[model samples]
Target: MDARKVEKITALLISAMIVCLSFSGEWDWQTVGIYAGSNMPERLLYPFFHTNMFHALLNSWCLLSIIFIYDIGIGRLLSAYMIAVTVPVDTLGYFTTMDSPTVGLSGLVFALFGSISFEVLRKRYYQLWMLFYLVAGFLFPGINAVLHLWCYVLGLIMALLNKPVKIMHHER
Candidate 1:
């Protein structure tokens, strides 16, 4: 199978999974998202769910865009995705005492943004745009700006520690 084909399939499957999960429940993030009293499973699982269809679609779009734009292989993308999901759950989720629980894939989206920024697009303008977006994110109600920042920093560190390897297609 061609590597590009596999990458596209993987991204599509992931995006579909996220959207499907969002539809599986009528409960909002407040009901299932990670809160201070949330169990371990909730912490780990909350990133996969979203509050609504619009949120799900936006996240899915970002996820697909990042994967396609950066040409990230499944292994690398999965690694960063896991890190984005788990690190915050175990770290900040342990210490934060917010009234609301955290949910959605924005953290992973920002992580991918950070990874692409550091490894592939080092342009100052791109980074400035991300910075502006990050700042603007704080102004929106119900946004987890802290989680986004943490994931972005984590993504940057992951890029520094292990740079992304572009996948090459070979037909046999």
Candidate 2:
């Protein structure tokens, strides 16, 4: 499939899931939120839902930008997204003192950003921006900085492990 099609489809599907699930009350804290002792299903599904349309749209925009800009392959995009969502929940869910359910694709967005940062290390802004965002998120209310950090690390590791080759072309 074309990269453009994959990017559009991924973004559309994610936005659709958030919108459709929002109407069904799946965003309710008790229903689909991730927390310590939550079932596996809740941990897996919460990332596809969000607290509000604005939250969903913000995440969607970040997701779209990363995939389109990097031209991330479908396999890499899906694998990273799933890992970003579930891994942080399992690892960090036990450590949080939150009174509400956590939801959003910020982790996935950060993961992609991290991957891009690793793939193109000369562009230092990605790492710097991630650090700035993490600090900002920590100071903000209701933001999960730890999860973002974890996802970013996971993405960097993914890039390191894959070590994708970039073929350079020179004009004759």
Candidate 3:
């Protein structure tokens, strides 16, 4: 199968996961934090929980959309970069705010914002898409808004420092 086909399937699967999660109907913020936290002394095969079905579904949808767009526009490398950068940043946020107990994909969304900034800068052209992304970033509200902005700035820097690759070569 082609890369595009693979990406489409991935997007669909992620979206489906989000939709299914939304209907699970289990919510617990503190338990989720303990499960997903980075400071796990014990080795558990699975260590993550959700505040509620809606929370999982919402995050899954956000993640799926970000992955879909990243695959479509940039390719898997940058998508991986975004995810790599996002996890640490988000984990830091969670640890720092352990008292608050936060759980969501806002961090990943912020990573997407970072990816977008990179795209806009590298292309040297700000089209409607960039504007839409900027607006979306500004309008979206969550504890990680600042984190998203910081990651975006960092991503832009990463993109700028990295040499450009031929996107057309991978085009189907």
Q: How many clashes show up per model? A: 0, 0, 3
In model 2, which range of ten residues has the least summed lDDT? Answer: 88-97
Please tell me which model should have the higher TM-score, number 1 or number 3: 1
Model 3: residues with Cα > 4 Å off, grouped in runs = 34-37, 40-99, 118-142, 163-172
Query: Where does candidate 1 have its weakest 10-residue lDDT segment?
Result: 88-97
Report the lDDT tens digits of candidate 3 across residue range 116-138: 55454455454355456555755
Pairs of colliding residues, candidate 1? none
97-125 in candidate 2: lDDT tens per residue?
A: 56677778888787887677665646677
Q: How many clashes would you count in candidate 1? A: 0
TM agreement with the true structure for every prediction: 0.81, 0.82, 0.53
For candidate 2, the lDDT comes to 0.75
In Å, residue 7's CA in model 2 sits off its true spot by: 3.3
lDDT of each: 0.77, 0.75, 0.50
Tell me the spans in candidate 2 whose CA falls farther than 4 Å from its real position. Answer: 1-3, 23-26, 88-95, 164-172
